[model samples]
Target: MGGVSETHQMAPRPRRRRRPYRLAAALLVLLGLAGYYLVQNESTGGDGAPHCTVVAGGDAGGSYSMNLEQARYAATIAAVGTARKMPERAVTIAMATAMQESALRNLDHGDRDSLGLFQQRPSQGWGTPAQIMDPVYSAGIFYDRLKEDVPDYADLPLTVAAQKVQRSGFPDAYAKHEPDAALLAAAFTGRAPGALSCSGPLPQDTGDATRVKAELVKVFGSALAPKAGPPASRVAAQQAPADDSEVTLSVSGKDYQGPADQRRGWELANWTVAHAAELGVQRVSYGSKAWIAGKNKGRWIDKAPGKSGDGDPRNAGPDDVRIFVAPLNR
Candidate 1:
């Protein structure tokens, strides 16, 4: 009681604690920002999420990039041209046209009755909706019209040729896609060997040999028809005395001749690689190079034809384009 009156400190005011809700709110804001960046990165292909690119001029030329879906349809468009014996230039024209019209999407909806890769209108006599929807069919008619209607389309300006076929309100739009389309045409037409590559995740289901063969034949015509032989094996094939892969596309040694034949082989081989993911193709090989799905699916493996070493699968015969499919998931 003796002059200690000022000692009433009131328990130090119980040091104010930080609120838990405020900390949670701050953490949530940080998480949301991180998630947004991750999505943006994936969308821009910062990771390997099934993308393709074409390098036309080795290192000197400009390159183009496309998602897997665009690559598949683009390959089909190129195959249709080549299958009809259309020149590489013709394929370039057709691809550019499709890129401008539909961005290579097999859309079921479009301007009026327009549909499919070419946005061909069934009402305009392109084909039935179902037919137009088929990439092979749409591409086939596009080339036919380009050839029959404009027999000298190759010599014309790329835009002029495309506009004649498309009759689009935006006629000049196609010309912008020509440089990229040409890169696609060269790789897909097999004129520029090993110029295209696709990398990404594998499908959950396995590849079907029959489906693979059918698509090849449909796209490349009779040149890719399977030879008369034993039925496809339940097991995969190798470079042994007997080629036992699911499908064998003989680039016809007897008929497949000259530089064109090599180009043909490369064309079919490149196409198989392009459709590998969709068709569940496990491996595709021609000449000395082979592409295997999964981790090494990004690039072609160089191995001697009719030989397998270094744990690599056997490549197709120098004259053959072989495709091996994965066994069914069942």
Candidate 2:
């Protein structure tokens, strides 16, 4: 045994060759992490950057997605059309025009003195700078012009109708946005219920009933807004405690837009969700569906029907919409 040991130089225990395995394992782990993050960012905007999507409703349906700000302006444009009782066709025309002109950014600058969503120039008498900058005001006037100046606009080709109002040098450009605009119009107009949603870094401000009602009235008009209850009610607003966090919008659906229907309720609900990032709306419930802010993809989940017991907003009527905003104290 001593003689064998003397002769044996244990051939430098052939270096285990473990490093290659270790490197392979490390690469696999890194690849796994990268895949996970990409998936998260695409689905939920995991960085908390706000995002919104509207899916067209049908068997051959498609979708369009955008950041939070553009979605808000789109909602306002559609609301202006609805408040005017203009058909969905008119809304599509206006949306396409805005997309071509401003990409819906509500730009304060454009060609020459042009400004606002439609890039209406002050020199053109669209309005004063201040009024034209207002999204609701700008959109309202656009629809007014379309209705007054373009007879039978709804039946015209979208590009033709939009070109007539916008008078853009790139007249054909509006037609390209028609697919995206039509999808948006259908969703925002309430013809495609639960078709719109947002994912977010929720706003930090507290929800204000007054602020919400004022926004609604601005878009839907004071005379036609659904009757309010409790904190937001015209009568109770003066006396109700300042802490009320939710507003009950009684949707008789009788006064605004076309004939009373469930779509009107969805219209209000979708608009609320589209602006939830700015308005501090935490939840919006209409009929049997509810949307929660900052949730993954901000999907509309089904809830039970009732008169305000569960976390779900009261579904006492078919058309009522309840908006639960972030509480000031929270």
Candidate 3:
């Protein structure tokens, strides 16, 4: 064959281009993933939806039944911090106090007609009966005091700070509820977002410790437990105690009967858990039944004879669902 001239030998035509469909498809997938994450973070819109549970008590027509609802609602609003802006430690302290004070209820009565979740006594001018009943308003007042008190009282014991504002009959009552409060704060503050959850009768927010534990497992996984048995060092517990206030929120009867109320309970629980360390909570428990070492399903249990319900004998009964907090040093 005769040798072709260099100019005559044309380069192979460039490969024909295909449509940009593949590139467009990849971009759409990326956008979809981003949106999903945003929703999960509850950043796409207002404070996002609350993740809460229900806690029933009494024969369904008693003080406990009524109080449970209040407690649940209190937990939800306390967790709010303007979307992701909430602090984990702050939420924890809120939970601890809620556990100790009113068992999370915004009650109308106390030692001297104390009102709202903190048991703000009308005698002491905490608030009027009507104002205390408003979850949002009540939570705001509590936070205001907390913000001021917590700054200087950061190193103080959980009970100590609580007592400064509460002036409770027993200053040490808040100490016990610290542990679980911390756990709930961690979950609610978005530090452990999606970590707090409920199971069993999801519809009923009974303060069952068993169900609380189950929710902990659902959120934090089995790794929440240490390789060894429960820790023995109080200081260690204080340093890094296992958060156990698994019952973030419980909408039993009066307080959180509606969906809005239930959502509010979840927010408070999450906030408390997220701020556990800051609030000085080490562990948390709720419902009529405390967490059964290793069980699920919270049953109605009476308070111990001497212990009293959450330390208040007047508050004790099979009907009441008490919230137990952990020690400061764990």
Best by lDDT: 2
**lDDT of residue 107 for candidate 1:** 95
What's the residue-level lDDT of 324 in candidate 2? Answer: 75
Query: Which stretches of model 2 miss by more than 4 angstroms?
Result: 1-48, 224-242, 253-259, 305-310, 327-330
Q: Tens digits of per-residue lDDT for model 1 on 95-126?
A: 99989888989999988988999899988889
Per-candidate TM vs. native? Answer: 0.79, 0.79, 0.40
What's the number of clashes in each of the models?
0, 0, 50
Model 3 TM-score (2 dp) = 0.40
Off by over 4 Å in 3: 1-71, 81-86, 199-330
RMSD of 2: 7.7
Clashing pairs in 2: none
The residue-level lDDT of candidate 1 at 34 comes to 89
Best of the two (1, 2) by lDDT: 2
Give me the overall lDDT of model 2. 0.79
> Which is better, 2 or 3, measured by lDDT?
2
